[model samples]
Target: MDKRYVRAAVIALMLAGLTLHGGIASAQQKRDTIRIGFVTFLSGPAAGPFGVPARMAAEAVVEQLNAGKAPAPYDTKGFGGTPIELVVIDEAGGTTKQVSEFRNLVSRQNVDYVIGYISSGDCLAIAPVAEEMKKVTVLFDCGTPRVFEEASYKYVFRTRPHATMDAVAAALYLLEQKSGVKSYGGINQNYAWGQDSWHDFDLAMKTLKPDARVTTSQMPKFGSGQYGAEISALIQSGSEVIHSSLWGGDLEAFMMQSVPRGLFRKSQLVLVAGEPYLHRLGANMPDGTIVGARGTHGVFAPDSNLNTWLKTIYKAKAGHDPNYPAYVATLAFLGLKTAFEKAKLEQASSLKPSDDALIATFEGLSFDSPSGRATMSLGKGHQAVMGTAYGTTKLVNGKVTVTNVKHYPAERVTPPNGISSPDWIKGGMKPGK
Candidate 1:
């Protein structure tokens, strides 16, 4: 009695299966946009300084690239005429959360690539995972030298020079600017980024001033917000100069806490990653303080067509000039764009290029950026090297201005390829002449 009913049910199931297959096939063939897994600290102490600016810059750059508004060499509409859609993820939680987030981005969301990580801890956690997954990942910020020195990954690359350059350039600037340079110490946040920065600076200072004593060194946890004890220790330790590579809200909080205690007034303060908060610090940034932007960023950025265009859009988005983090993020996008377009042009047959093809194009690739030209000349072309600049701050007409600026070449600051920063610094650090 149910023979006709059974046949009707079989036909209905077959039709449904066919419809699903057609839908899946259309999704695979008609997809014209590539999704990028963009991770940053959307909500955290680091958001205002590092994460927000980086996200803003990324949005601006991707929008311009999609519109074919980017300058020459990057004028192509997105990557090989394919639009880019960002699947933004917050990087506030610890490294474990970040690793989970990374997996979800790759496996669940199916992001074509990832461009993010403003923390060295996050980068370290994500790097091996990136290699394991064979997904292209670009690190925008996070200034630890250990990422490349400790290991190598084919799918991971950094667009910004590591923290070693920040400290090396800062030390060289200090020696050149001061006469005696008797004693110095540092206060760095307790993490890979902070530890690496302090280690490099300590070695550089020891190499440069053999007799100078280290009166005090403090390692505070990131976003501690209260540095009263550290400030008191540095002040009591009789250090003549204080060097700090702290960034984000931690850096700003240190200044706010240390200035009232007369720490900046009592001792020379060198803020290696302090250029971003120049406006927030304003007159509070302290005159005669040595400030560095990590690279040629902020007021230190050169006047170029790319710089002009980027600064205009970045300002409109960020409501202020682009800082080191913002510049580094945008540069990462530019580097990605340059490599993608170049790979596409070099091979017309491969419509969707393999990871190897893009990585091959990215290796040792040099590209024009808003700040200047960036070269992936270190870590066997897995890491980038860029010139760094340091300047003294001066309050003039109620605004903080960089005075007596000095620029150091990339060769002078960065360790050579195949040499770890510690080995390079400890072994007399031979630099290019």
Candidate 2:
């Protein structure tokens, strides 16, 4: 009588063991998709030039990686089986909104990494949160030196060169190309990027041509539609050269306003972040205007292998030529790919890599970018060592293009260690006592 009941109980136990084993097997078989949080101004005046292309580039890169169609040096799948799953967040308007979004991404969404921030202020605001959360943040296009300088967060790493490098490159180009240019004026947006750009350009120009005076300085509130007041002030000051750091809608509006006012006729206009707007502005942009990307122009002119491939892929996906935003997006992913590959190697060797391992992998890691080779220095601050490209604007065949291109080495412009940009400028500007 007991044997029959015992056999039934043994069968039940066997079924339960199989069920538990199957559950564990299913969990092990599930593929882990790397989650990345991407933040940008997707709906605003700045969206068209900076945010739109950035989103497009991100999608394109992910798509290519999944499809197994991307090339080497930037090939995402080359880092083994870690496929990325991006969760995009639209940081509606300001730095405050960006900080809020960053907290949500880290605390709530629990993303593996973060990649996008076009505004300098937003990047600066979010750097602390990244450090607190212990997330790897690959900043795409925030160029203000203050982001890396004022806040020395170990988790923050920028792919683009700082504003000071952009300013130095532009200043050197203007003096080398333009003849009989003595006095210059600056018209920049009233923000950290603008302030730093003008200050650095002034310093560089003073060093290159000491007697070259900066006659007029104007910093209009960003996104201001009309630049007539600033343009008039510069004209009245009788300066022969003008430098501007306006970007996105701000730059577009400035170009539309200043071109017809005969400002270009009076002075040689130098507009940073100009290549991105070339297609949008086309013939409306003043010819012979000196303009380029902040640190490096992101286009295939004649000698860039990566730029050529990027241009083709970007145009095929978005139906437009790739700009600096595309370059930033690509660089962001490249940095991630590099770190993950290194992490994988460490994991294979029976080592448990920490978040700092990811950061250390990027330190001194160099890769060929669309513009040129970019490397990170994990010194006092995790800043990038990247080159820049500059050129003059011209409408050729109904398309805007930057001609007579010149590339500048990054080390030539980066300031020395322990020296803040503001302090360096102040020291350089001081008169002999």
Model 1 Cα displacement at 90 (Å)? 0.7
Give the distance in Å from residue 24's predicted Cα in candidate 2 to where it truly belongs.
Answer: 20
Pairs clashing within candidate 1: none
C-alpha root-mean-square deviation, candidate 1: 5.6
Put down candidate 2 lDDT per residue, 1-433, tens digits, no spaces: 7898999999999999988775664444344667788887689877888888888888887877766567665564634456677889986678787887787677566677899898877887888888887888988887778876766777888876677767777877888897458899999888777887888888878877888888999999977778888878987988899888788777877878777878878789888667788788887788898887766656423357667777888889999777888888887887777666776677665322467777777776777666667777623436776767788888888988778888876665666555676565545523211
Reference-based lDDT, residue 89, model 1: 96
lDDT of 1 by residue, 1-433 (tens): 7799999999999999988775664455445687789999999888888898899999999999999998897888888888898888999998999999898788667788999999888998999999999999999998788899999889999988888888899999998988588899999998777777888899998887888889878999977889989988998988889999887778878888888888876789999888987888896799999999999988898889999999999988867788888899988999988888788877767545678889998989999999898998787788998998999999998889999999889988988888888888887778843
RMSD of each: 5.6, 9.5
Candidate 2 has a TM-score of 0.86
